[model samples]
Each structure stands twice: as C-alpha cells, then as structure tokens.
Target: MTQVRFMNWYLKIAIGSAIIGGGMEFFMINTSFYDKVTVLEAEKGAYENSPQSQAMREALNPWRNKDTEATKTP
Candidate 1:
C-alpha cells in the first residue's frame, strides 16, 4: 500500500513538471518568434528607405506614368 502511494506521488510530480516545462517552452518560442518578426520589420523599413530603393522607384517612374504622359501629348 505504501509503495502504491509513493508511485502515485511520483506520477503527480512528473506530470506537474511536464506541464510547467511545456508552458515555459511555449512562452520562449512565442517570444523568439516576435523578436525575429520585429527584426525583419526593421530591416524591411531600412531597405525601403535606402538610396537603392529610391533609385529603383525613380527608374520605374516613367513606366508608371506612361499613360498620363501619353494622354497629355495628344
């Protein structure tokens, strides 16, 4: 009877530890995901505001405004 009681206690402790460990792992993974997303967002903003982006936009402006220029010419 005492051995059975000890086994029950050990099982409870093991289950409780598993639950706590899973919760901690879930929190860490979510935190890491958000941190990576934030870094990617900042990098995207930097790339969009860079000189190369401006030059590309300028280079493509003629094609983007092609219809407007055609209408004005006639």
Candidate 2:
C-alpha cells in the first residue's frame, strides 16, 4: 500500500510539471508571435507610405487621372 501511494504521488508530480512546462512554452510562443506580427505591421505601414508604393499605385491605375480630365470644360 505504501508503494502504491508513492507511485501515485510521483505520477501526480510528473503530470503537474508537464502541464506547467507546456503552459510556459505556450506563453513564450504567443509572445514571440505577437512581437513578430508587430514588427511586420510597422514595416508594412512604412512601406505603404513610401514613394515607391505611391509610384506602384500610379503605375497600376493609369486611368486614375482621367476623371478630372473628363469633367474639364473643353
């Protein structure tokens, strides 16, 4: 009966430690992912506001200026 009690205690400790370790790992991974996403968002915002992005937009939409021309009195 004593051996059985000891075994039960050992199993409980093992399971508890495993759960704690998994929780720590999950927290670390989520923190890392959040940091990465933040950095990427900042970089994306910077790129979108740059001249290169504006030039690309103009190049992609060549007819963007035609509306003003069409409304002009000739």
Poorest stretch of ten by lDDT in candidate 2 = 28-37
Candidate 2 ranges with C-alpha deviation above 4 Å: 1-31, 68-74
Clashes of each: 0, 0
lDDT of each: 0.92, 0.94
TM-score versus the correct structure, for each prediction: 0.44, 0.50
Error of 1 at 45 (Å): 28
> Highest lDDT among the candidates is held by which one?
2
Q: What is the lDDT of candidate 1?
A: 0.92
Local accuracy of candidate 1 as per-residue lDDT tens digits, 1-74: 99999999999999999999999989979779778888999999999999999889979884877888899997
Question: Candidate 1 regions off by >4 Å?
Answer: 33-74
Q: What is the overall TM-score of model 2 with all chains considered together?
A: 0.50
Question: Which pairs of residues collide in model 1?
Answer: none
